[model samples]
Target: MNYRKLALTLAVLALPGVANAHVGLHTDGAMAGVSHPFSGLDHILAMVAVGFWASTLGGRARWIVPAAFVSVMALGGLMGIYGVPLPMVETGIALTVAVLGLLVAFEVKVPTAAAAVIVGICALFHGHAHGSELPEMAHAGGYVAGFMAATIVLHLIGIGLASLRFGKAGLIVGRLAGAAVALAGAVLIAG
Candidate 1:
């Protein structure tokens, strides 16, 4: 993969004001969706950690876990769009970041199926948040697609970082990143 290009793309996408300036709640649904994940530190950390954890697992998990998250998250989004009430949505999202970060930091090894299930649960909360916040005028299909694309990119970033092949040192670096994510989650919960 072209790391430079990927990094550049992510940098561009992560620009803070672009989405807000162009895609308001009543504006372009696609841009709004794309911008949503990057707008919140909580969403970014959890999505990236999901990728990092999947890579740490190192196998079929490299793909299955992320896929499961995306699929299940979309389902959760539908629930939100349809006005299904999920209590503690914010708490669930915060907990997801904390738990996923801890999983990455500790290098917890679990079966691929188990990992998928865990990530799937996290995705539900995230998707619900997305759904609930969607603008009334935004096209649902376009919005979902935009967010899903952004999400996949974040996951890919995590996978790329973990695949750096620095051996033991790389593992340490990954753990540190995970720790940072966990710390951010804690701050989110506390604040």
Candidate 2:
């Protein structure tokens, strides 16, 4: 009845749920490619995290790194659609979560190009999984668009959040998040 109670309730309802599966996973070719990024928690987190990292790192990395992720992810999706099999796609996706999380958690900074490449590799696995799993969606086209739109929004949020404080505070939080992501990855691997 009160504002506090209402906010808490809203938060709980907003959390990830099983029904999320219905939100994405269609493959209307290019349309699906565009949308798939937003459908799942893993993809959303990973994508957004890149944007945050890019913004924090500043300069070209802000755009380059996320762009690398999306581009390579698209390639991976194509591979999946064509049945180009990659070993442990699911595990790879999990690993991506963990590794990227660590990057955020630790605030690890490497060369701009290197960071992009690393994220790109991770994106590939994530994208492939999405592409391969399209059949479950029934009508893949709209699903892709939904997912893609969601994905971009998440990225923007990450960029915005990184700017919330900037400087030392943002740096600390970014590293902490990276560590959290790593932990998440470990959990995924165990599962």
Candidate 3:
């Protein structure tokens, strides 16, 4: 992409309208859930990073890692709905973003089970944030479905990107993207 295109894309992404789409909008159900994942940069980055890491692991991990995240996320959401408190939720979320990104950058290949566990722990923080912010009037089931669907889409995107092996250049690009994600997480932590 040319500099102009890159600048435009970044500018569009930085727009408040895109980032804060969920703010002040009162949706009765699934739409609210779907929008929530896209609303926060932290959620988007971490979820995608999970996918990227999974793809790097290859084989069964492609499915297992994401499955673990979604499954555990649901449990975390339930805990949030029931008002179970988890300390430093925001901090945890931000830290996961950084850690996940680094995992992708380094192409770390832990055992599939271990990767699932790590991803599951990260999902809890994300899922709780989603659940705790549920609108009183929204249908809980629909909202959860929507958010999970959106999250799946994000994961697919990351997997698709990671699956591309355009020689060493592609590998370098993937690493660079991971580093950028890590930097974003650090910025989130600072902010």
**In terms of lDDT, which candidate is strongest?**
1
Candidate 2 vs candidate 3, lDDT winner = 3
Q: The CA-based lDDT of model 2 is what? A: 0.68
lDDT (C-alpha, whole model) for all candidates:
0.85, 0.68, 0.84
lDDT head-to-head 1 vs 2, winner:
1
RMSD for each of the candidates: 3.8, 8.3, 7.5
Error of 1 at 147 (Å): 0.6
lDDT tens digits, residue span 1-191, model 2: 36346435533433323244545533333345444565566777787787777776788787678778767766776677678989999889888888887777766788899999898898789768876766653444443433344455566667767778567776677677767767777988899
lDDT score at residue 43, model 3, on the 0-100 scale: 97
Task: State residue 35's C-alpha deviation in candidate 2, in Å.
Answer: 6.4
Score candidate 1 by TM-score against the native: 0.86
Give lDDT for model 1.
0.85
lDDT of 1 by residue, 1-191 (tens): 76468657765654433546543453557777777888898999999999889998988898889889989988888888889999999989998998999999999999999999999999999999998888788888777877787888889888887888498888788888889888888887886
Q: After superposition, how far is residue 168 of candidate 3 from its true place, in Å?
A: 0.3
